[model samples]
Each structure stands twice: as structure tokens, then as C-alpha cells.
Target: MTPPVPAADAPADRRRELRADCSACAGLCCVLPAFAASADFAIDKPAGRACVHLTPDAHCGIHADLRQRGFPGCTVFDCFGAGQRLVQVAAVERPVADPGVAAAFPVLRQLHELLWYLTEAAGLPLPAPLRAEVADLTGRTEALAAGGPAALAAVDAAAVRAGAGELLGRVSAAARPGGRDRRDADLVGAVLRGADLRRHGLRGAYLIGADLRGADLRGADLLGADLRGADLRGADLTGALFLTRPQVAAARGDGATRLPAALERPAHWGAAAPVRTRRPRRPGGRGGAAGR
Candidate 1:
């Protein structure tokens, strides 16, 4: 047996940052994945079926030792704000266990993830032309986040994408000096640590070779954005609207990568880091068995 990797303790400040309103949820995240008996997972679970490792109270069995026990994937998965966006904001009153709720879960989950990116994007600098819209956009994002999952499921996705795209265009403009007409600007090879590109449009922009450590890409629209060779260490891509699957699939990352809601790290990235042991598993939660 692989010697158990001791869990790392989370820094107090960081723990406060990752804290979320999980109480408003019905534990949707733990049960929705397409699980199979693979190196990363010890069980085979179907879509819509709860994972065997999930306790009756809807918590992970292996809340600790995630990497050592072969469920490291859970540790790196960030719902960004998808869980709260759906369960608390959008689906406020409806219990996820309700008889009529099953059919929309998949779509709702994806939509909530998109919302997370957009909300994050809204914080970026806006062009003079779009600055006026940022306040309204921010308010709207907050409202949507507070809407329950059921409310989110009922939204028109196309409209949401369009709004996010508009915001991205504004961010792209602000990135340029003197507001140069850089609608097609190239940011490849730029060192952009902690740069705020929230809600900015970078559609079809070139971002290869950018060192985006701690960059805020929340709610920034990235449709057709070229991200080849971009370094996203510690970058928060949460709630970036219009970020397509292919764009994310094409981007590269390592252990330091942090994605927005509902997205998992690439299998090639290896297992998620072990949870810190300082934070003991919440009382009454169970740890996963070696195999299911």
C-alpha cells in the first residue's frame, strides 16, 4: 500500500477565502460527476447516482486523505460559485431531492459554472464606452448568484453569453495603454501577475506565453481566445463568461492551476494535493474505503 500522504493544513487566510455558503445547498457537487473505477477513483458511479463515497448527509466520505486514497480529483475541483449559484441563489426553495428536479440538473450545473465565470469577470477594468455598464452588470451578477438553481436553469443561456462577450471587449480595451485601438491586441509573453481582466472581452486575442500568476479572469469573455502556452499559475478563471470547452481544453496547467466552478483539472495534471490535516474532517463525516 502507498503510505498515506499526510494532509496539509490550510492557511487560515486561505481557508477564509475558499469558504462558501454550503449550507444553502443539497450537496449536489459530490454526486454529479461521471464516475468510473479508474486510478483516480475506486468506484463506478453513474450520472445522477450518488457516489458510494458520499455519506447519507451528502458529504464526502474521504474529506481527508483525498490524494492518498485515489480521489484526488475532488480536491482540485472548484465549483467557483456554481453550487451556491444554483442551489442557493437560483434554486432557493426547491429541494434537490424533489421528484421533478432530476431532469435539469446537468444543464443547470453547467449554466451555474458559466455564471461563476461571468461574475468574476465583471471586476475587470472597463473601457470608457463600457464603464457605465459595469455597475449594472455587477448588480445583475450578484442577483443571479443569489437566485436558486431552479431559477438559473430557466435562464436564456444565449443572452447571458452575449452580455459577457460585450464585457470582455471592454476589458481588452483597458489593457492597452492610452486606450489604443487594440481590439486584436496580442498579450503573448506578457508578465501579468495579479492583473485584473475581469469581464473584459478578449475574443480571438492572442495570449500565448503570458505569465498570468494571480490574474483575475473572472467574468471575462474568452470566445475564440487563443491561450496556447499561457501560464495561469494561481490565476482565478472563475466566472469567466463565454469561456468555451475547447479553449479550456487547449490551455495548459500544472498543480498550481485553479479553475472556475464545476471544472476539473485535466487527468494529465495528476492528483489533487492532499487536504491539510489541521482541519479535521467535520464531525460525523465518513472517510472513503480503499475500494468500492
Candidate 2:
């Protein structure tokens, strides 16, 4: 089974569990997961097989050019620090090409993701009762994660996620007072630029390809929201609830975009086109003095 959450003063490393540390990882993601030749991948590859783009040093050979080389999906994927943690827990001394590590990576990943969500939930400001429940659940989940590989393999991650979802729902409801319930709304390719979505309940909403430029998303609950291809230029997502790093990484944003405290601006965001402003015309006709 998975481990319980550590103490309140748990080691700093445990508290910052979701931050990806690729340098410390054994490239489990490049070798363990199966990929089909869809819009996401350039070719089909079986599970436990390393990608052709992976280098001898367990790094992606095309890391800097993934999107240009037909692997845009790779750019959005994140293991949430699970790859490195799994390597340590599984005692993986060999390269990621080892079938044993590949086979166990998926299970460990699921457990780690649960830890990530639970850790986030625990930090939310909820009612005393709800906060206590979240603490309890987080502890239990952390305990499961601390278990050995055999225990992790036997964990029911879906069930844990379901339970955590209930707690998170309550947390969302409490955080976003008077928010609209737009759960699972089909907003694909929407033209909602500059819209006021502050404090809205957008859990699991399909916002893919939506025009959200300059939108106000403060305090909005975005758990599980599909933000792929959404334009977030000049948008303010400050204090937005449950906005995962992967969701932000999948969307498009410019330098003017504001994010929640827990998240970081994705590196790809630096490539976004800069926002332009029109210069004001002179008070008088072109080449004429004002008030002439």
C-alpha cells in the first residue's frame, strides 16, 4: 500500500515532492511508457522500450526541438518528480533500459501523482473539519508512498484519487464562494478573450484551444481542466486553485501572463509572441500641432 503523509515539519524534500528533478532521474519516462503514432508521437513504441531520441546518458536527444520534430506531446508531459523518486525507491543502479525498473515505474508514478494532489490539497485553506480530514488522508497516502515497491505495486491509486477528489471538491466549494459550477463544460475552441472567470468552478472543464487572453481567473478552481492550446497571454491566474504545472505547460502564455504562487512559468512560454500595443495618435491630424 502507499505511505501516509509525513509530519507537518517533514523534510523539505518531501514537502517539495512534485517539483521535477530530471537531472537526478534515470529517464524512466523515456523508456517505460508506450507511445503510439498519434498527433502526439512520431512513431509507435512498446512499453519498456526506450525512445529512439533518448541518448546514452538517459537524456532526450531532441529535448530542445521536441515540438519541431513531431513530439509536441513530449513537451507537455511531466512525471512530477516521480521518475527520480522511483529510481531511488527501486534501487535502480543500472540504466533505465532495465526491464524491472520499467515495469514498476508506472505503478510508482501513479502513487507519486496521488501524493502530489494530496500535498496540494493539504495546503489549501479549508474549514477546520475539512482541513483535518485532508490532513488525515494526506498522512495515509504518504504512508503508502513510503512503502517498498511491492507495496506500491499493490496500491489502489484510482480509489485513492476518488477519495481525494471528494475532499478536493469540498475544498473547492469552500474556496470559491459563489462560483459557477462549470464542471466538465465543453468549451473547446471558445472565444472568451478578456472574460471574467474569477472564482468560477471549472473543475474538469474542457477548455482546450480557448481564447483566454487577458481573462481574469483569480481564485478559479481549475482541477483537471484541460488547458491544452489555450491562449493565456496577459491573463491573471493569481491564486487560481489546483492549477497543476502540466496544465500550465500545455497552454500558450506570454511574458505578461500571471500565475499562481505554487506554479512556475513553463520554459516554452518564453517563446510566446510578445503582446503589442497600439501607439496613440496625435490630438491633431497627422503632422499637425495639437489644438492648432
Candidate 3:
């Protein structure tokens, strides 16, 4: 039988519970993924080695100045609370965490990501059956995350993700009637300024460097959509679905960009895009007194 996921045993904020608490983590991310030197990362680091900037106590040496120190890539990385969960649940003690943790972190991260999505989906006005499905899947996913490292290592994470994706697709369809579907489209650097893209399905779309200034993106489904350097000045994203912090932080959005209440305006973005308003012309014609 699957074990119940560990919780705080009292009323708590699920959103906060699902977020990264690096203080509680063992710095799993610093040692897990290989880093390629690029615009995002300053150095190429091999996997399974602690980052050069990682402190003895599992803290980042350049936490406040990561971007300035050439590690902007680390700024947007979130494990959705996986690292800490492993530290707490597995009782990992480290100068080096157990090899099992290295093996299990990726699997646990994926499960935790699914949990984040399911939690958001539950809040949407899904139908009764869909709501129940979300609840069931959420429970199952929690059970998967609750397991020991052995069980986590044995899980077919991709298969579980595929199942969850299918369910999310159905949920998206129900929630977005007659929305345009653009799943997995390579729309890199496309100019879509001032477009009406409400309720559009853009799952897994490559929107890299796209110009999206002043676009209306209300209720758009942006699951796994890459928004790296995408311009979102004055774009309205109210009610957009499945839009995560990393995605928002990667994109360029000014204060005028209307984000969903759940997300914060990225600090890097400019204060506000210039607002344009048309001046009313006098009925007389062009260059009339009012127009002047």
C-alpha cells in the first residue's frame, strides 16, 4: 500500500508547502544537474559535484549576487519543495547526501511538480468528475512522493506524467471552450503584439524571444511553454492557467503586464510600459481643434 504523504499535521498553506524552502533543503540542485556554460550559467559543472559557490552548510555563497556572479540560471530554479522533503523524510545527513538521494531527486522533483499542477487544477472551476479526478490523482501523486527512496527509484515517472498530462488535457478542454490549440508549436521569435489570445492552448510551445507586447492572454494555458526573453510589456495574463514562476521570471514583463493574482511581477522587469491612449478628434476632420 502507498504511504500517505507527510504533512505538517495542522492547517497550513498548501501553496507555501509546495514551494522551495532552501533553508530546509540539503542543496540537492547544486549537486544534481550538469550545467552547460551559456547565457544562463557562468560555468560548465559536471553532475554529482557540489557547485563551486555552494557553502559548507549547503547555502549558496553568492546568494544575493548570483546573477552578477554569472549564475542567473540558479535564480529561477525551483524544486517545488522536493529537496527539503528528501532531507526531512529520508533523514539525510550530509557533507554528501546518500547516493540514493542523488538517484531519487529527479523522480521526486517530477512528482512534486505534478502535485503543484494538481493543486492549481483543483482550484479551477472544474466539473464534478474532473474535480474528483484531480483529487484522486493528487492523492496518488502524494502517495508516490511519500514513499521511500527505493519506491521512488522504481516509479516510472514518465508514464505517470503521461497519464497526468492526459487528464490535464481533458480538464483544459472543459475549462477552455473553443480555445485555439497550439500545443508543441515552434513559435520562436514570432511577433504577436496586441493579439487576442485568450483561452489559447500553448502547452509545450517554444516561444523563445517572441514579441508579445500588449497581448491579451487571459485564460491561456501555458503549461511547459518556454518564455525565455519573450516580451510581455503591457500583456494581460489574468486567469492564465498553469503559468509557473520560473516561466514568468524568464520572460520580460513590465509592471503594465497584468499577471494572475497568484504570481508576482518579476523584479527584473521594468517599472511600467508606456501606456498609449488615442486622443479624440473633433468632428470637423483631421487637424481639428480637439485633435490639435
Candidate 4:
């Protein structure tokens, strides 16, 4: 059995810098995606239109109280540094209305996400050949993302993503042999507390609202898993593969939740944290309710 790959220090730093730099960004996320009034959003926002809460200098007006104000989606949405990248590429004071900027934003966003995964995959304990392949792909994706808006628009992001996904699958299978295959399973709201899920294949699994508290998920391949609202308190995710920020941000993890070193714990998980080995009941009291 291949030993679990600890998150590599070099790549982990790269991944941290890969996340959204809101201060340098011009609130592209606030204007790029449409927000239909729903559970996550409180208003109907048209595509390409600046959100009502967006300040003139491109900051969210109600950032501190987004969830309480009925915009929980805003809390979990991460652009993976695409917003600032766009601003740098365009060099324009306002990028919200530029058709080229608008078109390039999404494609660059997807590429940057792939870059994140590829960066992590490159760090895994794979054979030399696979490692080389990961490096090659990373270099190519970086080159592609470095292009100006016109070059970015010319990119076929879907095709690139498809190839990357396939390669990543190979990397995961090779790195974590004998993992259970549960790709694309619909496990919404399933109670799976304290389960031994080591090396499981959970790619694209619908784990929405699933009770996974204290689950042993070490080495599980979680590529594209829909982790929205999943309870992850006390869970051991030290080496969970392909785990992305958006998935973790959408989930309900606590300070006790062990994540890959590359990931930042969602602030809503708590303002502070301490490692706890023991499993506790769905916590409450002074803390808000947990487990959906």
C-alpha cells in the first residue's frame, strides 16, 4: 500500500497564495455571477451587474454579516485569485463591463482551480513518471493562465479540465490503491458518523448535509465532492486528496476538524481552534447549532 502523502510544504504555500486576495481585487465576484434569490442569496442580481452591496471602491458593504443578512453563499464563494489576476491582466480601473474581461474571468477561474489541484497532485508520492506529468501539466496551465484576456478567451477550458481530471484520476488511483469507489454517489443527508473511510473514492459525491462527524477520511480522494453543509467536526482529513477550499468552505467543520495542511479552515468554523482527538456529540449551547 502506498503511504499517505503528507501535504508538501512548497505546494501548500503556493495553494495559500492561490486563494482570493480581496484587497487587490475589484470585486469581480460581486458582479460576475448572477445571484438568484434563494437559500444562499437574499437578492436577484443580474449577470455582469454590480451587486447592490458592492461599495464604489469594490468591497462588499455587508461582508461581516453576510450569513445573518441572508447571503450565506457569499461566505463560501472563493475566486481562487482569479479576480486579481483579471485586474492585473486588464490594467483597467473598471473591469465589470469589459466584454473581454467578463468572458475571460470564468475561463481563468476554472484554469486557476485546475492549477490548484495540479499543484497539489504534483506534491503527492507518485512514481517519477506521474510526477513528471503533473509538473508538465502545471507548467502548461500556468503558461495558459499567464496570457492576456484575448489569449485567455481563446482557451478551451472544458477540454483542458477534462484532460486534467483524467490525469488526476490516474494519479489518485496510483497513489491510493484499493480505495473504495463511490464516485458520484448521492449521499445527501446520510448519517455516516465515525466511519472508517480511509482511501475512499468520493469524487463528485453529493454529500450535502451528510452527518460525517469524526469520520476517518484520511487519504480519501474527494475531487469535486459537493460538501455543502456536511458535518465534519473532529474528522481526520490529514491527507484527503483533491479537497478544495470551496468544498471545505461550504461544509460545517470545526476547530477539531483536521484538514490537509494546504487548506485554510473556514472562519465560520470558529474564530479560534484547538486540536481535539475525541469525538463529541453534535455541539451546541453558546455555539450556534451544528449538523443539518
Best-performing candidate as measured by TM-score: 4
lDDT of 2 by residue, 1-292 (tens): 3333333432356547767787888778888788999888999988878899888787889898998899988888888777788778877653565655664566666666767666666666566777688779878877877776667767777888888888889878876789888999999999999999999999999999999999999989998999999999889999898888889989999888989766778887875345455555676646434323
Model 2 deviation from the true structure expressed as Cα RMSD, one decimal place: 7.0
> How high a TM-score does candidate 2 get?
0.85
Provide backbone clash counts, one per model.
Answer: 38, 15, 0, 0
User: How do the predictions measure up, each by TM-score?
Assistant: 0.49, 0.85, 0.87, 0.89
Tens digit per residue, CA lDDT, model 1, 1-292: 2232232332344223223445555666665556777755766767667766667665666766676788655554555435554554345342344422443455454444444444333444444345446546656655654445456457666676577666655544453324223235688888888898776666677887788877887756565677756777667787554464445644566666656544556655555555333444546766444311
RMSD list, candidates in order: 15.9, 7.0, 6.5, 6.4
lDDT of 4 by residue, 1-292 (tens): 4444453445556776589999888888898788899999999999989999999898899999999999999988888888898898798565376788888989999999998889878777777777778889999999999999999999999999999999999998986899999999999999999999999999999999999999999999999999999999988998999998889989998878999878888888974366534444445634323422
Worst 10 residues of 3 by lDDT: 3-12
Displacement of the residue 163 alpha carbon in candidate 1, Å: 3.5
What TM-score does prediction 1 earn? Answer: 0.49
Flag the better candidate by lDDT, 1 or 3: 3
lDDT of 3 by residue, 85-178 (tens): 8888788655354678877889998998888788778777666777789889999999999998888989999999999999999878877889
How big is the positional error of residue 102 in model 1, measured in Å on the Cα after superposition?
Answer: 4.5
